[model samples]
Target chain A: MQALVIAAHGSHLNPDASDPTYAHADTVRETGAFDEVREAFWKEEPHFREVIRTLESDEVFVVPLFISEGYFTEQVIPRELRLEEWDPEKWDSDGTDASQATLEATDVGKTIHYCGPVGTHDAMTDVIVQRAESVTEDPNVGEGVGLAVVGHGTERNENSAKAVEYHTERIREQDRFDEVEALFMDEEPEVDDVTEFFESEDVVVVPLFIADGYHTQEDIPEDMGLTEDYRLGWNVPADVDGHRIWYAGAVGTEDLMADVILERAADAGADLGDAIERVRAATAAGTGDEPRSEPEPGAGAGD
Target chain B: MSESTSDLEALLAAADDGVAFDGLRLEHEGDGYALETPDIERTGLDEGALRDALETVPAYVSNWQYWQREIRGDGTARRAFLRRCERAPLADDESADHQPVADDVALSVPERYDALANGIDREWGQLCITVRFVDVENPDGERVYDLWHVDDAGNDLADLEVYDDPRDARALATEDEDGRYRPLKTAPTLRSGWAFTGLSGQELVDAVEFFYPATVANWHRELHGELDVDHWLETAERQTGIYDVIDELPREAVDWMAEACCVDSQCLRRREWQYEEGDDLEVDGGDGAFPCREPCSLVVAAARKWTVLESEEERTYELELTTSELNQLTDLIDAVAEGRTDEVREADVYDGANRYRARYLRAKRFDEDGNLEATERDGE
Candidate 1:
């Protein structure tokens, strides 16, 4: 079985935008679970259309390294890769139906199992929780801390905002923090209104983006007055009103997501249990032979 | 200096209209002297209070003399004086002595200019004046001052006339239109057209510093390399309404799309746009339209799926399947897709078979209801 991760590449103007995706892919490739683990991109090389042509595996599992199940997953991925025939009318309003559910292969000789985008998985909430905790000055006590899940909401699509709200609820259910609010860059209950949303003095804002790109690195920080500098992860100490605000890197960049990717592959019939155990055993033995694959010569190393 | 009644009358007689002493008088009080401008009727000061006010007369006279000297030499000081006159009476605590040296006075203009002033105000915007220094060589080098309209913000909004004579620049500095100080420019540089003419370099820079503070701050930031390309790009993006939606996509997808087609499809000019395999997607040919301005159908579809995944509400479905039954179900899916339905039937006896059968039944019901067009089409 082979694993193929698809992502949107960073812009030429801003190279660091796609760094997290490449970093995550490199981490997953080191696990040696699949015969091959290669990443394809929509904006960079190798292009998605050409990526499949390069594949040698008869059975492949494709996982979208996306934050949501938006236009890309339902339309673009299926159409480009010819994974499945998607008819909006055939499925329920939620776009999920038993007949159309997971791991259905196409008629071609290749068996491709497409998994849900990494962002929507139940385990992703844990990643968000971890991100919030990592940046919080005091993680043990969430009494005064506010968790703000910020997303790029659009008037073009209500689903975009809904996805953010979904994650907000999941993180809120953990009951770890005093408050959890879903905020957006372009919509109401906006990022600018974060100060009003939280009564707590310490607010941890985790961008619900898949990659630490422009919105995460530039827009969010500028809006929050976290820093004028644009980079990934924790910004310099910042505040809104009198509340201390901590900014985390995008939720998708977390290392635990490698595990989630493997789990998704497992659900798609990749059977990673043995390979994971092998990798774990190698790590436990301190063998220093952790099967980390060297990137292809032309594959750009993220900064 | 102390003077008798005759000396006071003589000083008042010599004062002209410009001195602002039309109805002035002086009166002696207990152990002090009272001097009144526009008379005691307007001032409404009692004899004892007027005596105390007389002591401040020396300081006020000295301040007025100093201001006259400064205003004569400094165009900015003159403008400040004129601005103060246009407004109401200066508050007792608020005086020319207390005003800070305008920011532009401290800024050293490039050596090319004989005089320049850049003033910035958050409320009123920016003002700038620059006079070019020219050296003409004959037998002796002759210095010439030519005032040029240079938009320091790079925004050509100031309607300024180039002046060969320094007097013209100075005259324009003090010029007033409609009772307000003219040449007070407003942002974002496209809308401003006011240009103050006659001012000394210090005054011009000071006016600019006073008028458009943010522009000066931005200039300072740029000069120090504190304003990075990303910051500028972000600012440009915000102003132009060019959202960073590309960043919202996965990094790999961004790279692939950049290689495959123009990621910016909104500006595509062609009626029926198609991304040719080897076509250059990066170049927009100055039209803001890349070869493909919008994502390809594939990317759009995938993005839709991603959105759905992101927005979809979570619901837990618990299933109790034995190891063998789970394996069988997994196997059956592959077998069915591979057209090995016989193998699927063989696994029908598994513990999860009833659940799987129920799904098939539900699907059959949907199919009978004419709701499963995709399934029906696939079967055909």
Candidate 2:
């Protein structure tokens, strides 16, 4: 059994940005589904290149801890890891091809399963709903509360905005809040236009970023007229206009995503049963008793 | 309540109502509440009692106002003000504790220097002092002292006044201007070069290291041939857009250049013909001449290397794979790195695989010929 590597874009300036990613990886490692679970970052150590060199396992599952399938996923990641050839134009023109969606192990000599970005998963809507519900003083009382899904939309790529829009629709379908609005840091509808989106007195903004980096920690708060030191989860309630704005942490850090990550691995043809059995056998051999079956799904999510 | 407390309360009430008690008056000047009681005898209280009462009244009033604001509106400003009050020494405590021990205390020159240094360190927050010895043979061996006012982070805030006489510097340290100490200027400068006549290189380095601990660490790193990348990067990141390469000079060198001659080729000082014409060769100093903006040789060399490093970029990838698949990928990469193509089986041509092959071949070719050009195409 090989390792499950979570790739994240860590920041040099902000420590809080990459903390959640490592915390989530630790949770998934505790599941005993893979031989090892590790975190590889772009900025911080252990750097992605350095991490690969240290890996003992040949078969690796890499789950991008990103919000969208854009330049990073299509060009940068493959180029760095020596993955198969990919045309950005083709992928951009008509989304991902079903045949090329999950890279087969036989094709690359060593099996490397490239899963869809964790943020783009269908299960993320549940996480988004939970994040929105967590910040509201009264989740049941939706009278004056609005949910705003904030994403890092780029003018360079329409897919970035589309991913945010997809999640917005999913969250809206749940009908948990009075109103749900999709907002972007770049391009329209901008995050600054948040006030005009709803007539509600309370706005619960759930940042759809993978990490709580500079954009989530600093830029978003500043743009929304909130004071600095506002953090992930329920922040110190900021007064924008006459309404109370509550900001939640990035969506990818949610506990539910642990299950999504496993699902992603399973979709990429990982044998979860075999990995679980190997762990259980190793534990039983060491302790002289059978270990608990797959110790709960969200074990390491919030840590 | 004590009799003194009751008397103080009554005095405060009279002061609040804008009423004059005896010959003294308590009035509100703008936002500040002040008691104008220059003559303590006119208030029918002893000098000590009057001073105590005055101190207690303002704190009580301020506390009352703080609470009033908290109850009526958001208490952000009130809370901050209260915090400031808590941190600041009370008026009575300052008066009692800060009183000088004696006007004339006979002390040796060394003792006086120690006392002055201690007083400046305690009163002016963070301060760095450098003393340069000059005219060692003269009866009164002259020395120039440079004092740098620094912030809590040890970042230089200002170049405090230089002094040739230790007595004059000590007097400035002990002087209490108005009720509070005089604040240092907001901007920093390297002024009045302290020239030493006979000090060796090691002695000068030791003197600098004593004042600035960061410089000591920098010196240690230099001995081991290590660059302080963080410090260099911090200076580089401050500038925006396209800037002259000279602007990227190391901060210490820039500071040195500002106080010395222009190293820039275009400068009149660098041109020998300007000196030949009996032109009083001008050195870089003062506002207009300081901070030579032209590309100097030192700056040009550093800028060339900096641009190369800054231009290169690295990317990271994230992939998902089954347990067995990850192991095989590892093997494939290892085989390629070691030039064992026979061990490296052909995988389906994908973006990652193709990229890996090119990198592997490049490395392999480089190892074989000691140059990547051996594998490069005609125009490439």
Tens digit of per-residue lDDT, candidate 2, span B20-68: 4222355544553455533322234443554465654433333232222
Candidate 2 chain B weakest ten by summed lDDT: B181-190
Per-prediction DockQ comes to: 0.01, 0.01
lDDT of 1 by residue, A1-303 (tens): 465554454343343555566666656666666765656665443344434533446677777777766676656566555456554433243521111224333433466666767776665676677666556534353666888988888765566676678878976776878999999999888897778888988888888887776677778887876655555434434766888888886877765566556656776677664544433233221222222222222222111
- CAPRI-style quality class for the chain A–B interface of candidate 1: incorrect
Model number with the top lDDT = 2
Off by over 4 Å in 1: A9-12, A88-108, A137-141, A228-235, A274-303, B1-380
DockQ, prediction 2: 0.01
Candidate 2 C-alpha lDDT tens digits along A41-76 = 655434443344334356788887876777666665
